[model samples]
Every structure is written in structure tokens, then in C-alpha cells.
Target: MSTIENLLPEELLETLRDRAPGYDEENSFFHRDLADLKKLGYLQMLVPTEFGGRGFTLAQASQAQRRLAQAAPATALGINMHHVILGMAYTLWLRGDQRLNWVFEEAMAGEIFAFGISEAGNDAVLFDSVSTARRVTEGYRISGTKIFTSLSPVWTRLMVHAQVEGEDTLVFGFLEREAEGITIKDDWDTLGMRASQSCTTILDEVPLNTERVATHTPLGPNPDPVVWGIFGTFELLLASVYTGIGERAVSLACEIVAKRRSHVKQAPYAHDPDIRWQIASAGILMDGVILQLEKLTADVDALGTDRDPNYGAQWFLHFSGVKGRATEAAKEAVELAVRTTGGAQYFRSSELQRLYRDVLAGLYHPSDNESLHAAYAKALLGPAS
Candidate 1:
């Protein structure tokens, strides 16, 4: 690990985890807890050291998000934006964009940088931006709607993607917190990760100065910027959430199981061998997910701040696979808890049942498992295979 990555003490992380809000069965309440993360510098870990910031590598930042995910998936989702924005802008900065210096400085001064991708009814909004940036005499005019925009409510600055000059080329732009006509719809009700406050955002004629935009052309369609690889940071972040979810599931399941009277109660699940098998199977899944994340993250960190020049299909495939594997494990482990708990799991007061519902919703964050499935299959059938 880099000296910088090692600087964040374990005790501090534990304290942050301890202070994180409990997983509320009601989604919106989880979202209200987002304010706590903003009070900390967790949102700006990516600013360069020259800017008086941590400038953590993708691996280090992913580890932090994943560690936190071990506690609150919802809270992790709320903050993953900072890591993504940092990694993205850090790459641009590496390519000699001095314009990003102020943004880095702002981050060092404790600004939350959010990525306005993932619109409502759309999954891969990063690749396809419905938001368009039209050139004006002064700068540009941006207008459109984005869904699941995390951490923007408390953000002082933002990193947004839109079509520049009404051209096919996609561009990244910065938006101020007090920008005119920037509205947020917090009606995001879902099964999990409710603390994200990932509401829909509407930009109606928001002015963006020329000095505030990045990515004059698409950095995708191959490997120059490794946009998909850049997206790997998010996948890893979600993987951390899964690891945390599994850890919490086991802890909660064991506590409840210990309370059940094995001999007195005529319980079907209490002593069934099948239940034992299910428990063992869930353990295997959790172990596999953790192993994969640890290995991948170690490799990412070893790569340091230099973004890879070539995009390996296998690495990309691994990234796509982890989210599906981890998400499925988290949901399955929680569902197993619900089943083992029996009919009582249905009661309004059942924590196992609440965990099941609340856990599954986070599966939808960033790249949905279903979309990654299709994308993975297409890659295999390509001529390169």
C-alpha cells in the first residue's frame, strides 16, 4: 500500500462505522443520514497531494468504500460518487489538464464532487447522456434530467456529463451548488440503499462556463481513457457493500438463531440438515466474494495512479462479474436468514425480513446485475474471443 493509503488510521474508520446510522426499514430515513458523511473529508480523498489532499489511489479509495460498505450499503452508495469523481478527474489531471487544479483545491477544502450519471429508467447513463450542453456566447447551457445522483444535496461543486455543443461528443461539466434552475426530486423509494437520497435532478438552462468543462470528446468506444475500467471503481465499491452486507447478515442471523429454543420449539428450520447446508453455502458465497474483491483491489492499487493504456477484456469481464456475484451473495445470504427465521420473518418487527428488503435495493446501484450479464455475454461472442 502507498504511504498515503496507510495514513487513514483503522481506528478512525471504525469510529465512522460505529457512528453510521442503523439500517432503517424505511428507505428515506436512511437517506437523511447523508449529512453525516459530508461533515467528514471522506468525500475528497482523491484531491492530489500537491493540492494538500490525500490523493488516494483507486485501490485505496475502493478499500475505504468497501470497508464502509461492510457497515452501511446505503451510506456507501451516498459517498461512492466522491471516489468516482476523484478517479475520473485525477485521470484527466494526469493527462495535463491544469484547469482541474482549482477543483482539486476545492476538494482539499472539503467539497463533495458528485457525478450526475444514471438517469431514471436508465442504467448506463454514463455511456448515454440524455443531458445536452449547448454552446452559448459566454459558455454553455445545460438541460436535462438525471436520476440517482448521489451526494449532490450537500455538495459544493459537481462533475456532470452532457453532450457538448449539441454534438455527438460527450463532455464533462462542473456545476455550482447554487446554480440557477438546478432542482432535485427526492422521491426515490426503493428496497435498499435508501440512505443515498439518490433523487432525480433536473437542469433547466443551467449556465456552464467554458473553463468549467472537461472531455470535449468521447473518451470511450475503445480504450484511450478506459471509461469502463474507470467504472470498475464503482463495481469494487459495490463489492465492498456486499462484503459488509454479508458480514452484517451473519452477525444478525447468529444472534437471532441463538435465541431460538432448539429442543422445546417444534421448529422446522431449527434443526433441519437442509438449513445447515444453506448456511454453509452462504458462507462459501461470502468467502468467494471477499476473496475476489481483495485480489482485484490489490491489483488496482499496485497499478498506482497511472491509468492503464490498454483495456483488457478479461479485467473488464472480472469487474462486470464481481458486482453480479457480490450482489447476488448479499441478497441470497439475507434471504437465507429470512427463510431460516420461518413465518415469523414476515412480521413487521422482523429484522431478518427488513434486512432482506433493505439489502436487495442496493443491488440496483450503479450497474444492475442484469445489464452486466448482457454486456459480459456480448464481449465473449465478439471476434476478439
Candidate 2:
């Protein structure tokens, strides 16, 4: 079990932390950070060991992501998009589905994959898409705009999907960054997680050859292994990042309480029972998030190649719960930290203030509270009559 402590040394994390604020303040991409990560072979963490990579499991990768988020939330969140793609491919490979083995091969060859699945108004998730893929001589011509294309600055490949013309299926494929009619719009200005550079990507007749297409699946839910792999990996990794944020918030709160002095008592705020209680509460909330993350990751690894036929629905139920809980826990922990640390934390320069804004982005991700609850209801009580 190669932990993040061994894979990503403390010195690298410290450097990432030092660079994080500057990137956030400038609303720039973490270019240097990405280069360093590549140098350290962090991008190949999910590639199989036989393919000249470390071949880490989901449990190990989740742990690594949690630690990365503690140093730089935006960086971790942005890179997580790439990791999710690889994680899904690796998961399917581990389950005896070698359809996506090329993804691992590409990773070993030093190609970076970015996610391009999000659209402006369509929220049907993996079940539907607004983009259209017109049949072409070689493969398909993808024409649509994708939002929140993380790793926009440096991704060599993009994993995208679109509805096939005159068919009831959607085409999932990878497109080269330099493909014709591809435009990356620099419109990612937001409240927090600014360094992620998750800009809008436009595709106008972007051509993908036959080899680049990964799969063609029917619209809506089905028993597709790829779909389940993606949903599971994405939700779990996203949850892990926010869990890291919560843990960092709790740590910061403890440090503040230990160092700050009470004017009335002329003693450290740590001595104040009320402040101690707040810190303890934050710790407890973060503990729940971390435990859920750990358990879910372990379950994912344990599934191996023997997953049950109905495991997809069960996985969805569990993933939705963990994602929602982790995000909420992170937000609550940051709020408690802000309260315990005083008004200074309200300033723009305060790390807690940045964390406060960053944690809010968690709410916008897929499997949001309403959708998560809906899935849970469907799984628990069965669909409406």
C-alpha cells in the first residue's frame, strides 16, 4: 500500500501549497504544478503496473486525492477530472473488461485526459446528451459545447459524449486537443476554485476516428459496465476531495484555537470550553466524511471482478449518499472554522475565506442533494406507482 506520504512527498505538497494562493489570486491555471506532477508520475497513478506505472487502487488514489486537496483544493479538484477518467477505465479493466485498456496505455505514454461531458442545461447526467454526433466517413463529427472542461490548459485528450443522429444511443469517445473546429473558451471566472481553469469547450464538427470511440450505449439507464465504473469513480473521488477540505478546516480551527488569546481570561482560546466544543464538533463532522470515503473506496476495490448483476444500482445509492454527505460536511466544517477563528478569517487573504468559497463549489457537482435524495428514494422505496 503505497500511501500519498510516499508517492507525493511532503516537500512537493509544501511547494504546491506555496503556489496555490498565487494561482488563485491571478485566476490562472496551475501550470507549474501540473508540470511537477507529471515529473513525479502522479498522472500515471491509475495506469496498471505492467504498463510502466504504479497501478494504485481506488482506495489508494482516494487517499492521495484527500491529501492533495488539503494543500490546494482547486488543483486537486481540477486534476480529479483526469483521475476520474483513468479511474473509470482502470475499474473496468479490473473487472475483466479490457475495452478501455487503451486509456491505460495512453497514460503510460504520457497523455493527459480531460473530462468534457458537462453541458449548460442538460442534467440527465450519463443518460442523455444535448450534443450531436453525425456519422462521418471515418468515425463521427461531434458538434456541441461542453462546460466545466477541467485541465483545459494542458489536456492532450478529452473524453466526451454526444447523441448519435437517428439512433437511440449515445457515442462516447476521446478527441485530440488539436482536432479541427475545437475551441477552448476562457470563461471560467468564478467565486472560488479559480485555479482549476475549468473553461468552456466548443466543438464544431470535431472529428473522432473509429479508434478513438470508446463505446455506444443506449440512452437512459442500463447494465453497462462503463457507465457504472464512471459514476462510481467520479462520485467517490469528488467526495474524497471535499473530505480533504473538511479535514483541513478542522486542523486550521484547532490551530487557531490553540494560538489565539482571550482578552477577558488572558489565556489561550483553547482553554475556552465553548471554543473547544466547536473545534471538537468540526473534527467529528470531518471524521464522518473521511470514514464514509474510506469505506466506499474499500468496497469498490473489494468488488473486483465479481460484482453482482444488480450492483450498479446499489453502487449508485451508496455513492450518492457519500458525495452529498462529504460536501455538506466540508461546508459545515469550514463554517465552524470561520466562527471559531474570528472576523479575520473573513478577509480575502485568509485561507479559511478561500476554503469557505471553495467548499461551495462542491454543491454544484453531480449527484446534488435533490438528485441524490431522489436516487436514494428510488432505490429504497422503489419507483413511484
Candidate 3:
């Protein structure tokens, strides 16, 4: 209750089992029950101590995400966007963006923050977004349209990206949501993760003062420290969300098979060895995902607060590929649940449909599959691969 720790990771698994009643017809992003998150301060788990909020560890945050995913897929998504913003923005404000102290201070007081990185031109991290921020008399005039601005509808401060070409200089700066001339466009109707309210952000000649911009990427230490943590958080959350959906599908499978009457063998469908095998296969994949996450978490923790690495992008590459694998595994788990449950579970009331769509959304992260694998392999056996 005092926000000493993440509070829910250990408790949420139980609450999800007891409290989640599948999908309620009236439940959605604007639902009432989600207020439990804010009331309980789960929304500010990663806010820094100096900023007046408790900041949990990477593993704790990851575990909480898994637990939330089990409760309600939509609520989990909405909560995820909030938590990710707090974690990333909190870290940046606390460790890197010293000049932007007021933004950090406001977040500590429970102000919500969101990331607005995806733009109309640059959907992926590797792309050069066309958003331009030219120098004006007062500060800077930013003109751009960013799509998929998650958590913006409800969040207070949004961290945005724009470029500035100085005298022989090109720099990236992080701007605030309240900056003059910035507007949030609520047009997000994605096939999945809809509860996140991922809308478009319009920055039409926004004026940013000296306090709004964070320094170049990797505000902490290395050549690209900022991106490293963001990438890592993205990868871990991918695994956690998928793991949640996988657990849900498996649970539904167990329920249906238990009720099934084994007309062929004169026993319940629960006794069917084939169905059992399918469940076992799904379990195997889930197990694989957990193992990979364990390894990834440990590897990241080992990196510590260190500065630079020659193979700086190694972790980023690993995250992209592993995320793809875990996402596929989660999809398999959901499919197995639907397949083994038969046609009856396909009803409109079934939660499996929503979970199915959520897992599918995990597939499109705009990454390089071959490049990821090749990088990992090259790291192991020289760059020949």
C-alpha cells in the first residue's frame, strides 16, 4: 500500500486467478475496474525516488506485466503503455535529462507520461523520420505527424522526437506534450492493443523552451545508451505479454477439456491423450519462452550501469530476434487452445478471440529477422555469417 516494492507481481498472479471473470460485455479501456491500477499506484511503479515515486527493478516490472496480461488483455495493454512510459521516461529524467528537472518532478507527483516516437514516415527505429524542428525566434518550430502515440489520450506529458540541423550539426531532442502548438490526434483504431488509445500526435510549429528537450539518444553514457534500455524494455515486455496470453489460452483449454465427454472412449474428453499432448506441446513452447526471458534478463542486469561497448548493438539485435520467437510461441499457445477446445469455444463470448488478436499484434515490430539472427551468429563465429 505504501509503494515499497512493485506490490503486485507476487500478489497479482493470485488476483488474476481469482478476480478475472473473462471478458465483461461492458468492459473496455474506459472501464471502471482499471482505476484499481491508479488507485493502487501500480501506474507509477517505475517513477524515481527523487521524483517522489517508487521505482521498481527491471525484473519486477517485467513480472508485473505478465500478471496484468493474465487479468485482462486490454487492461494489460493500457497498463503496459503507461508503465513503459514511466520506466523509460523516468530513467531518462532521473539519470540523463538533468536539464528537464520539472518534467521529472511532475511525474513524481503522479503526472502520467507517454512516448510519442512513431511518426508518419518513420515507423521503425532504423528509419529517418521526416519530422522537422526548425529554429524560431522564441525556441523551435516543430512540424510533424506521429502515429501510434500510445498513452497520449490519458497521459499528461509526452516525450517526442525531432531533429535540429545547426551550423554543421544535426541533433535529436526530446520535447514535452504541453509545448505550444502540439496537439494529440485521437484516431487510433488498430486491430489490436486498442485499449492503449494509441493515437496520432500533431506537432505544428510547436515552441519548445530550454527545459523541454532531453539530450541525444542514450542520455546516460555510451554512444547510444538511450536506445539500449528502450530496446531491452521492449523485448522483455514482448515476452511478458505473450506469456500472459499463452497462460490464458492454456487455462481455457484445461477448462473445456474437463467439461468434454469422451464419447469415443466412454470417458471425459479430459482423458484424451491427443488433447493432452497438444497441451503438453504448448507447455513446452511456453517453457522455452520463459527460459529465453530468464537468460535475457540476466544478461541485461549484467550490463549494469556501464557506459560503452564495441558490440553496442548486440543486445538490441538479440531482443529483436528473441521477441519474434517468443511472440510466435505465444501465438502457438493460443492456437493450440482454440484448436483443442473445438468449435464450441469459438463463440462470440469466448476470450480466446481477443487474446488471439493481441498475440498476432506482437508479430509486427518492424524488425530485421535475418539481420538479427545473422548478428547473433556472427557474434559467436566471426562476421562471416
Taken over the whole model, the C-alpha lDDT of each candidate is 0.66, 0.89, 0.64
Q: What tens digits encode model 2's per-residue C-alpha lDDT throughout 62-161?
A: 9999999999999999999989999989878877788889898888888889989989888777878999999999999999999999999989999999
lDDT of 1 at 144: 88
Per-candidate TM equals 0.81, 0.97, 0.81
lDDT of 1 by residue, 189-276 (tens): 7665666667778999888888886556573443434364356666777677666777667666666665665565566344667666
C-alpha RMSD for every candidate = 4.2, 1.6, 4.4
Per-residue lDDT value at 203 in model 1: 91
Q: Top lDDT: which candidate number? A: 2
Off by over 4 Å in 1: 1-40, 48-50, 90-102, 121-124, 224-230, 264-272, 304-315, 342-345, 348-351, 383-385
Tell me which residue pairs clash in candidate 3.
218-225, 218-226
Model 2 misplaced stretches (Cα beyond 4 Å): 305-312
Residues forming the 10-long window of minimal summed lDDT in candidate 2? 303-312
Please provide, for model 3 over 159-232, each residue's C-alpha lDDT reduced to its tens digit, 9 standing for 90 to 100.
65566644322234456566677787657666666665667888888766555555454212233444555556
